[model samples]
Target: MPDAKQMVECPVAAMLELIGGKWKPVILYFLGSGTRRFGEIAVRIPTISRKVLTQQLKELEHDKLIMRKQYKEIPPRVEYSLTDLGESLSPVLAEMSIWGKKNVLEKR
Candidate 1:
């Protein structure tokens, strides 16, 4: 009920802006189990190139969906985990999993 100059966004579109992509949801689903190192994620999603994965992770981090932590040591260590915002997507991810299993996997 605002002025015509006010901009409105579709809820789904807004959500997609934060998490839409070929890999964001997959990344989120994997991280749902727990924290993961870069190599571990790379291994799980074998098809994604390291460059693309790194870009996706950066975008997710910028959106506040994931946290990237760097440990100080002779050999630098990094781990990625979900932020509270990211955890909120668990229900959505669960539903997607169920849908995929029933509609995608079962039919195949």
Candidate 2:
């Protein structure tokens, strides 16, 4: 057992510190299918502002959770996809989804 005075870095606590927000997980959820353009993600998560989406994407990329690829062309193209670290988070998200459905949503 950890001493009460000791600081412990629990996995959930560490993860939440990185991706805890209104949009990060949802952004990741959409990216789970594969790569997506900025506009594509914005379309699916319509409630989030463009500015917010950009911020979240930057943060995810910085944390090495998502990879951003840019294509050079007449019209520049960019797409976001999960890194190996991010893909590993899918199981955790799935469990959260199951619990939310059973305990939270079902209660309502």
Candidate 3:
């Protein structure tokens, strides 16, 4: 992450820089279940445009948080799943989700 070092020095801010976004957290949370295809993720998060989803997935893959596997098939097949590091974020995401529900959503 030499490139990251050039931009961020603080650990927490750097972590946010890597994964913080309107869609990244949700996308990562969904993938925690298991491998899913592009369509499946799109279906799960219907409000997200396909273009944005594609972009976010690429960024997550680039950051080594998720893995993308392409398969040879008639229409082309691809799948996404969490890397070990990605899975390691599950507890953190879970707490965020819980907090969002209890402290954030409930107040609304």
Candidate 3: residue 41 Cα off by (Å): 0.3
lDDT of 2 by residue, 27-78 (tens): 8888888899999999999999999999999999999999999998869999
Q: What is the lDDT of every predicted structure here? A: 0.94, 0.91, 0.94
Over 4 Å off in model 1, which ranges? Answer: 1-8
What TM-score do all the candidates reach, one by one?
0.89, 0.89, 0.90
Task: Give the Å error, residue 24, model 3.
Answer: 0.2
Instruction: Name the runs in model 3 displaced over 4 angstroms.
Output: 1-8
lDDT of 2: 0.91
lDDT of 1 by residue, 42-105 (tens): 9999999999999999999999999999999868999999999999998999999999999999
- Tens digits of per-residue lDDT, candidate 3, 1-108, equal 557666677777878988999999999999999999999999999999999999999999999999999999989999999999999888889999999999999999
lDDT of 1 at 11: 65
The pairs that clash in candidate 1 are none
Q: Ten-residue segment with the worst summed lDDT in candidate 2? A: 2-11
Residue 43 in candidate 2, Cα distance off native in Å:
0.8
- Distance from true location, Cα of 31 in model 3, Å: 0.3
Tell me the alpha-carbon RMSD of every candidate: 3.4, 1.9, 4.4
Model 3: worst 10 consecutive residues (lDDT sum): 1-10
